[model samples]
Target: MGCGPSQARVLSQAPISSNPDEFFPYQGSGPWHTSRADSVMQPRLAKSGPASSEDCPPVTLQELLKKAAEEKGDKLALKVERPCPSLGSDGGAPPAFPDEEWKAWTYREYYDESRQAARGFMKLGFEAFDTLAIWGFNTPEWLLSALAAGFAGGKVGGLYPTDTPETAAFKIVHSGASVVVIEDKAKLERLIPALAQRGEATTRIKAFVAYGFEPEAQQSVEVKGSAKPVLSWSQLMTMGKEAKDSVTESSADPLELRLKAVEPGHCAVLVYTSGTTGEPKAVMLSHDCMVFETRTVLNLARAHMGLCAQAEQERVLSYLPLSHVAGAMVDICFPFVATATTPAWVTIYCARPYDLKVGSLGDRLRIARPTIFLGVPLVWEKVADKLRAIGAANSGLKKKLGNWAKSKGLKNSKARLMGGDGAAPFAYGLANKVILSKVKAKLGLDCVKFGATGAAPIRVDTLQYFGSLGITINEVYGMSESCAACTVSTDQAHLWGSCGFQLPGVEVKAFKVDPADISKKEECPRAPSMDDLGEEYQGELCFRGRSIMMGYLGQPDLGADHVREIERKTAETIDTEGWLHSGDKGMITKHGMVKITGRYKELIIGAGGENIAPVPIEDHIKACCDGVNEVMMIGDKRKYNVALITLKAVGANGETPGTDQLDAGARRINPNVSKISEALRDDVWIQEVTAAVKSANENGKVCPNNAFKIQKFMILPTNFSEEQGFLTPTKKLKRPIVENAFKKQIDMMYSSSETYVRYED
Candidate 1:
């Protein structure tokens, strides 16, 4: 019932379908004929269609880790770079082997360490189903802590390092976590005070474990009025070693007994939603949910990127926060799953922060040169902007050559989008040999065969812009509720501006809703056929699959009525039929690819009675306007759409400055043109953004009714960020929070007598 090697015998017995007519009926037609616009209409399903449960049995994380260690004992599992204080003096000599700072760990070593950590948790009295909350950036220790918790038969909840004290405390308290693992002293400082404030509510928390403590700095943090013991990483490990040695063969191993008690249906992790529309909720993902997602991703990689070969070496860079589902899948699960299947896969954990001033990501990428890369849209956008800025700074001839190569690459990319083999034109191949290849090598993407962008809607222009530079970033769509397993663009069948096809064993459909309906309880009619899909078939995207979450965690003791309400709402979301109602609005194309439009609750109903999705309008504005870092269309229930724009800080030369330079400028406290807020006051920058918005409206890329033909826009003094509670951890705008925070600004846009910026200037 397993896949790949485990199902080799079954697959060999099955007859392979080789009929050209069955695979590609219109082979004689040109590539453009295969586009979604003209392709045959079919139900939205996986490339191989729906798979039975028996075909892919669910496996637990502990089992997966154990199998990987047993199979790939000697293979490289992790690579982490640590500062070697012994090698060099901070004030004096440079260290030898500066480039060889990485500490390597094999699968066997990782397994042994994780097992020891599990025993340590047992010693700390962590029982089955007990919550173990981890807060940290991407590090080997973070991964080990998560796996160790799983091994100890406890569910793990991740807390983002950027979370404020109050927010972290809420998650920890809500998840009922008894053990909290902090990354370092900086995180501990923020969390300890919050935990102390909780008083009796946090009494269940038995211990606090902190890692990465500096040995030279002999400092101890005392939690005021709290008698709970706080243990260091080394102390916990020592306790585990002692405890393991004391155990006899006659006595049952506590860790082993707990592992045997684990079930596929048991909650493995509790991932909090981004809370874009409302307050965050804990999504309970079962062991089967994670296993299904991991297996589907691995299968997709093999089918799309040819990553299944035993000899092929796959490298992944873990940089994103493990608290997020996308980060957890890419940085933790993907590598572990791949290692279990093949020994050639390697994961590089990125601990160093990238300096925006010098653009260190490019430098790191050059070193890792990962074969598979996944990043949020912001990461990709920043890289794109950096590359464009570097190109603009180049001398006349070099800039011209680079621009020429980019144009050729764009042409090749467009052809590939239309289903043609991505072989570049003769001139393009020559240009790539002369310029593009070197550019890719310098950016450390020369070996990258697969690149993906998700977490938020990215501008099609941004995708094409990267493609023009020889990096085709495939857009993916998913949320934490689905265990980050949903639709994805593949090499075999993909379309520009689409999230691609559904994964195997997954079912997706659009539920058509009337725009005029404002009631929360309104149920839309199911569009079952192509004839029923009206203009703009976009509606609330719903799916049923093995990967959907069990349900949101409910507080049963709140009240009978409240508990009943929670159960009713949960039933409405997941339904009796097993379909999870995704709050996202999307449509399935004729080719079975899904195109996400916007969030259902975030849609704006204009005063003119036209329905508008803000994402397309915002994306269009950002693509047209270089000065704008973020644009939120805020005209809900208004006559026309007006935007709240946040401009990037400009330098002396009027160009957008890097974040580092801006931070330094702010620290100087000089009454000069250093701050982003000060830069926004410039008339020239205002006019630039105004003109960009006008151009975007005139171009009309989005639907006519939902166009960016806004009446007015107000420039905000500061950018929306997670620290300010205006943005989620994943960088998505918290619509309700932002709207409430800027209520005055929004009212002013409508009530003010100022003339709207026009296209005629």
Candidate 2:
């Protein structure tokens, strides 16, 4: 209302207004700091078609929140992330799913808490355009503060709580945030070292707030020869109360004020994404873009979460990192919309497994009875491994009854792993009613209505395992730059390896070997531009639409490289087009679904003259391994295949059976591991994975109708991590680290032996 926001430019998802005064937290800063003013308000036709009056008015996220708040002020708007209290220091027992102690905030509570945090930021001398840093594990406080700052139209950046002072400082200074929120003394202490190295580090960060600490807790600190204010979370409420009391009784219209400050074009989120070449790049996302993308996904996931027609009795368990876009949108935005629309109907608990260590997630799931569960590929693989472990232990009993059941037409018997299990892709009736059902019940996942998996490929074997258990794993494809979920599977059209169709309006196309480069001696010989392939051909996947990020915060070159625009016909690259060249390689299926092969950079060249995609293969391998946590395939320009497999430790202390029991299981070849492995090795899951690998080969297609196969492979011991320089913040592998760690095993595995010792974690 105050500023000249171009109505024509606003994004469909941008908020209609953000009344600074009407809202409890208010904008920590003024409108100048918001992404709306820059990215959306000055829109250059972000929508697909030319502007027209007939189009239905856009459903603004901003309007949605305010309306919901009005309709259900007493209803829960959002919940803060809380960690499991039961988890031991050494990552002992996984929290039981239904553990209720982890509830961090109710919707109304989270909204109020964030408002208070916003008020606390104001008391700490924070102003508009000023940024705040949240460094911690996924917890309610971190999320509350972040949203408060966002609503207030300020820049908010989340740093991993586990980050060293150096990494944390780099982001703090880069974002120029004056407020930093944390979880404990350990994270608080990091600032000291960072400030010691550079006094300016503390300059941008005027306050450090720790969550789950008492107001009177003596968490004081000093750096650069001066003391700093350490505010316990409880004290923040007092600050917000004080600040609210002091603001003029008559203030700017909350809705108008919000509309004035919010625009669609500005940077809304500053997420840190680690690149192959260097330090993390801050990926800037606009409010309008993110708000819109989230709405699409939320609507898609809504039905599964039982929010569709049920509208009530819904809950969510927040466990992913807040720094990641997926977690932020869901924990902060999704509930707000759901509340605004349904109000008082849905019940949600946003807590992490780490915070509720008292019980296993199994029990927590039972308590929450969450309708929707989202996770990464590693999680699904782990589930499969756990199932196999229990089945192996029960195979003997199953065998005794196997023939008897066969006589009863129990073709798809859910019995323990048996050769018969491979013949029938269905879950054994008894197995589901007994073994797996018990697992879900124990994990509190029995009532889970939907599941989402992303960040990596999930082998069909893994997917089928969950399907058999009566749990549907919804696979999503996205990246930090794409706000985490670009595409996801619904139970209706779910496929094993495909990432699913383009999200509602998003467009995806493959850019493989350029037609111009097909000549005997092509000019430049550059990587295939978008112009290379036609429909259904494999190539680097390039996409466009509202989901694209604004750019890297401080890295121009990298941002330019990622956001290339081009005309649809020529495949000519244009920096101005806003099309994102996703580094992921893929092919458009004739049916129009996208089949993501692997990362463009991670594609391995097989000695058999095939381009192999390791992700899918790795996905299956992890599925078959009892304790596999992560698997990295490495065989570029090498014969056959070899992998660096990090087995998931069975228990907190990496418990293994006694030698006698272990020998028994090992000697019997574990009917369970063998059956699962056989399914992976020949059940078409590994076949599909290896085929993807071969297709990625420079050799291109494997002569129509022929899918590539893994001639041979070796699975080795050891998992990679950031601490070990094996993974980036996004969880993608650092190939160099993995290759170096497994060079010897890889060499031997590819040798005539075609086998190696697989270690037990």
- Candidate with maximal lDDT: 1
Please state the error at residue 581 of candidate 1 in Å: 1.3
| TM-score leader | 1
Residue 709, model 1: Cα distance from true site in angstroms: 2.6
TM-score of 1: 0.84
- Per-candidate count of clashing residue pairs (backbone under 3 Å): 0, 76
Poorest 10 consecutive residues by lDDT, candidate 1: 1-10
Give the whole-model CA lDDT for all candidates, comma-separated.
0.67, 0.53
- Model 2 Cα displacement at 422 (Å)? 22
List, residue by residue over 471-540, the lDDT tens digit for candidate 2: 6566788776667676666554455556765665455556653534311111122223222333336666
* Candidate 1 lDDT, 508-573, residue by residue in tens: 667654344312323344333323334456677877566777777664323356445645556666
- Model 2 root mean square deviation, Cα atoms: 10.7
